[model samples]
Target: MSSFLTLSIVQSALELGCIYALVALALFVSFSLLNIADLSTDGCFTLGCAVGAVVTMAGHPFLAFFAAMAAGVASGFITAFLQTKMGVQSILAGIIVNTGLYTINLMVMGFSSNINLFNTNTIFSMAKELSESEVYRSWYKIIIVVCIVLLVCVFLAWFLNTSLGLSIRATGDNEYMVRASSINPGFTITVGLCVASAMTALSGAVLGQYQKSCDINYGTGQVTIALASLIIGESLIKKGSIFKRVIFVVLGSCLYRFIVAIALRMNLPAEALKLVSAVIVAIAISFPYLKEKAGFYKHRRDVMRQASKNV
Candidate 1:
């Protein structure tokens, strides 16, 4: 490939990777920390895009971003309420919220199934307007996104070590124990879900601005993709420090994007991308089990060989 082509591919991968990393971080909070599946991610992502795009079209790009985050928080809170107050299962609550958000997002977008932000003032556009050089304009959006991701990682790391964060973690680890300690596990769960949803919403808002459009199905199967990135990051880092783990989550997002880029370069069909994501997640999830099984077989084989020799 030409140098320019390679550069373009790399740039695209980096941008997408950052977005994926945000989603993965959100998933890490919900799945790894809160122990909730939180399937509302798919709808919340689309909701962010829709909210951002509509508000951008109305001449308030920054407000649009925050609005999207607010919408995501609301969605998350609803799911939490359903699970905690109404006695609904977490997975079921997520599904219900996810299903409801489709209509809500559509309503937010004025019944349009999709909206384009091209030429409209977006957060990135505003950033470009502030910078004088064309080169700066081209790179500023990505730089801002990287900064946001880094800030989020640092904040999350610090938060996880705090008393409230510990309580949240405890809820995930052992709800009964947390309840016994007089900590409200439900409240912790709600807070965690809200934070996770906000992260996802931020990702969607940025991605929509970057692409200059918002599509209704933009977040299809996002949970699997986020899980894949999280697991891949965890496997690669294998460290216990919360700070390092968060950094690894971002790295894993980039790695997942790189893999997808390579797969695209190989000319994989667009229709198969979901399958690829599923396969990647499956392999990551099953790796420990597979390793244990292999070790067991190897040990058994060694014991049998030793017995035969003795006989």
Candidate 2:
């Protein structure tokens, strides 16, 4: 336990938490705001990593960010098209896109399963170069990610306040009401998914650059992880403005990563990580319901006790 609390391990967990917080934010948009279940997240994340890594290796680290986001936009557009035009269910559209993205991601990686960037110049490297002292250098990654997350949170807060953004949130709450009110729910859904997917891709790009490599399975089970983070965040902050919620999302991601770090310290095997993720998700999902159940039982017991005293 003490070893897990070491500075280096804590820093590593913080880095991972910051990276994955983007995905949690993405889920907040698609799942919470748009009421969409986008199962294509894993593939989209890998696609971003592959595209970003390939482009970064070509000596264009900055361009890699936009390139990866563009790929994510294309992926999002296809998923939206399938749902809006082809009449596919939202979940099915995501599955179809996720499946097709696997091949596309592979192609982007030059048909290889992994791309090593051992000597590659990535965004992290660029950030590190901007720092002077060794201490500042160690903090570069966190600073970069924190700045990006802050910008994103501010942008999202403003966006959600806009008319179109309000329409997106309304569409999620009641599509028929939005439709009857002269707003196109389809358009709102499309835009929301695109924005969400782009955010997820950005997360992958950051993770890939930070790790200094890209693997075919880099994004496996990422959606579950994001969902868990989101749920944990919601648990922490039940009701708040968008800005507050976004902050909680970041906090939740950090907490989730911290838990994983502790588990790893306990000598949990790599193969069991997914199961651990599933359990965390289960607890998060059931927390509210379980709490309510306990409350109900307590109330009933209290009522019976009161009646017995009166008798």
Candidate 3:
């Protein structure tokens, strides 16, 4: 491929990576920090997109951001309420909310499955307007996504150190300990899920605006993608401080996107595309355990050999 073509592909990957990083960060908040799987992510994401698209259609692209987050917070609250107040299991609560959101998302979009925003004003369109005289005009999406991702990362780093943040982490680490400390695990979980869902919704808003369209199916399997990216990111920065680990999640998102881009270019059989994602996720999830097992076997073999020599 030509240099220009390569650069184009890389740029596409970067845009995708940056967008997905927001979801990974969302997962980080719930899965890593709050110890909640929050299976409602896929539905919550589409909810944001639908809500954002509808709101932004009314000539207030900026307001769409907060509106989507508010929708997300509501989704999180419902799920949390089920878990905390109704005594539903965490996973079951997520499933219940996720299924319920399908209708809710459709309702938000006026019972439509798709919304077209080709002529609408979006953050990217604004960026393009400002960068009309600059070479960065073509890269407006990347610029917007990177800025949003950075802001989320910074905000999360700050939030993760606050008293509430510490309580959330403590609840994640050990709910029993949190209860004994007079801190409410239920309260911490509710806050954590709300925050995570907000981030997820923000990402969906960005994606909807960037694509200039919203489709009901846009959020399918997003949780799996975010989980893979999260595992890959945490592996890359295994020993980092909280801030470093959080930032690396963005890097991992980009890296995951790059891997997918390359795979797509390889012209894999159409039937195998889904399988490819599954394999990637499986590797990301199991590689560490496999590595440790391999080392253990190697050490056992070496010990056996030494014992034979001594005998």
Question: Could you give the C-alpha RMSD of every candidate to the true structure, in order shown?
Answer: 2.6, 1.5, 2.0
lDDT tens digits, residue span 63-95, model 1? 887888898899889999999999999999999
> In terms of TM-score, which candidate is stronger, 1 or 2?
2
Deviation (Å) of 148 in candidate 2: 1.6
In candidate 3 the C-alpha lDDT for residue 233 amounts to 95
TM-score of 2: 0.96
TM-score of each: 0.91, 0.96, 0.94
- Residue 61, model 3: lDDT of 92
Query: Residue 33: error of model 1 in Å?
Result: 0.7
Model 3 per-residue lDDT tens digits across residues 121-205: 9988877887456567767778888888999999999998999888888988887788789898889889999999999998898
The ten-residue window of minimal lDDT in model 3 covers 131-140
> Candidate 1 local accuracy as lDDT?
0.87
Q: Which portions of model 2 show Cα errors greater than 4 Å?
A: none
| Candidate 1 TM-score to native | 0.91
Clashes of each: 0, 0, 0
Best by TM-score: 2
